[model samples]
Target: MTGERARVIVVGAGIAGVACARELAAAGVPVQIRERARVVGGRMASKRFDGRPADIGAAYFTVSDPDFARVVEGWRAAGLAREWTDTFVAYGADGRRAVPGPMRWAAPGGLRSLVTELAAGLPVTVDRLVLGVEPGPSVDGTPCEAVVLAMPGPQAALLLDPALADATRAVQAQQWTSTLSAVLRFPHRRWPDFAGAFVNDHPVLTVLCDDGDRRGDGEPVLVAHTTAEFAGRHLLQPTAAAAGVEEAVRDLIALPEPADHVHVHRWTYAKPAAGLPEAYHLDDDGVGLAGDAFGEPRVQTAWLSGRDLGRALARRLTA
Candidate 1:
């Protein structure tokens, strides 16, 4: 598939990249996705522990946009995704209280499976690291009609050449924060009954998700995301922070038992500190940028950003 004559080359095989490629393909445009990782999914990542999948990246997603809701419906019908919960417990000065909000969705197979589902049959090449994107609007000196960077701005900035001023400036203006996610596997369930919680004003923790509840399997596993400050301190050696994270979780829920195993994952550019007003950026140089950074950091936002960029590129190329 990599040998095909792809007019457009999409860097990053995350949901945004795959969504863009899917739209371009549907519009009869030729595009290919190149990902640095062995598999796609980007921030919506997952890991397996004892044969059970746990969400290690994004805990869950909320639906607001009608178009995105339709997409969610498809996933629900296909049994790739399910409604996890609408209420989450928030911890702060007032203490823990149930906060009702939009319906947050989850996947029984883990959130990554949703991206994998969207990427099926797409011309995606894994382990294909992009070196640079130059003025010819080419990738690694190989020219294409356009290049779509569907990743964090920090990552995309690495590939943009100084000559591509528009793209370079757009990417440079983006600021992102880091995070460390830890998955703790215990012998049995011992935490509270909540499926998820938002940790506010904490120096160590940011969010916690009951992996068992979210996965709909009740496997006695918990996933914790640390604050940017905490993550920054241990970015160099994320595993070392696992002990602190586990302790925070235990204390937060008053658990007496310790986790049998813990695994930590580092996301250097976990999420955009803020987002641009536009859904995506397409410059005259034929270099486009798409990701959650284009809007709020949500699964729907990433998909919409990529989908919009693909449609725009298709129209431009077809014209």
Candidate 2:
């Protein structure tokens, strides 16, 4: 790492962090990204089962903001992303009904690929966990022009020093929820033909996705996301929740054969309970915070939050 490089350190390699770094790099801000995970893509995670990848994080992403749309278009052009569906089945007291909305996008290689593509040519260090963010607006002991915490507020709060009153207060004010994603690989596709469904008002499951349909591969795999309440009960032993999750999925769709394989992933801070009006929080102390908590908890929102924060940081540093 050169002295001139990494003037700004953006923690968390999720879409938000990567998006922030992209903006800073575009503005020639010399930014560096540090991801504690082995790979990037925070919540937009994918795990492989029997050599086939299944989305275990964000089920799908939508495009709305003109800026985010353009970003999605680039991914589309590069064959990294594709339009998945515009409708989803909702299961509630009234029974199942098709809910039409914006077109949700998916990646053949999994959503994580999209982030990887976006972070191309940028300096990203994986498996490099940051211990602390201190008074000098520094990462661990390394000083930087600015520091962006592009993750869940709770996670950011852990790294913040109490002395950084403004940033600390901003993060502590945020509340988040947990979730568990279970991937069920079936021997064959016997479930409904829907691409995805909103398991509304369910105690166990909240969302279900046809992994085969979304990946455009037509495989007999399904991914189910558990409600925060259910996940909270199984956070300690996430794998122990797999059987219960699979049973609930089978009961919901009434499948004949059980899932041949099941894998579970836990998200302690899966989503924010509410969002602030601001796009991001950038304190005069040169400490910045960005994530979906700034708005609706969605992939686009997280990206926009980071993009806005990066621009703000760039302007401040440049000025």
Candidate 3:
């Protein structure tokens, strides 16, 4: 697909990029997705363990927008996703308690599969890292009619051409939080039956997910996300923090001790501290930004932001 570049080039093959490309393609505009990773699904990621795949990033996603609800409904009907839970157990120095929230959703093939499904048939160029864009809106020296950066604020800001210096500073002003995801596998199920638990006031752990129950087949695995502070402190040496996270996983879930094996993943930009108030941004040159950080850092927000940008860009191109 990279043999011939299209008029519109979307950098990043995550959900936002794919969704934007799909919309542009539907509008009779040719677009191609360029991703640095071998596969898509930025924070909505999954990786291999011993045999099966494990969700190492973004334990689950919640839907709120009516437009996003319709999208979720279709995914539900199509078997791309399922309701994970609405209530999660909250942890304190004292004990465990339940907290009710939005209906959380999960995918059988890990959250990454949903992005893969959404991007089906879309032209995606993987392992293609973008250096930066020229003011001509060129991507890595390849000129294109437009370029859509579907990534976090800081990462996107690095690609801004000098012509968009003001926008770059604005983008740079945005803040993001890092995360360390640890997935533990057990010889047998030993933890509580809760869907997920929120670890509060913990120095090491922040959130935990029962992967077995989540995947719908009931395999013995647990996924834990660490506090932003913890992740930042151990960003350079993520493994150094794994021992503490494992301890929390055991105690927070009322387990005896550590699991059989573990896998650790670091997210340098896991989530946004705050997103831009707008749904999307497009300078006069059609160079734009779309992602969860463009609005709210959620799965639905990413999709909506991308879709909205696509529609906006389509109108601009068709006009």
The whole-model lDDT of each prediction reads 0.92, 0.92, 0.86
- Expressed as tens digits, the lDDT of each residue in 29-91 for candidate 2 is 898999999999999899877677789999999988999999999999999899999999999
Residue pairs in collision within model 2: none
Alpha-carbon RMSD, each predicted model: 1.1, 1.1, 1.7
Among all windows of 10 consecutive residues in model 2, the one with the lowest summed lDDT is 1-10
How does residue 108 of candidate 2 score in lDDT?
Answer: 95
Q: After superposition, how far is residue 105 of candidate 3 from its true place, in Å?
A: 0.6
- The order by descending lDDT is 2, 1, 3
Error of 3 at 298 (Å): 0.9
Candidate 3: the clashing residue pairs are none
lDDT by residue for model 3 (17-125), tens? 8889999989988898999999998888998776677888888899888987887788889998999899999989778889999989999888898889888888887
Candidate 2, number of clashes: 0
Score residue 73 of candidate 3 by CA lDDT: 86
Candidate 2: segments with Cα more than 4 A from true spot: 1-3
Q: Each candidate's TM vs. the true structure? A: 0.98, 0.98, 0.95
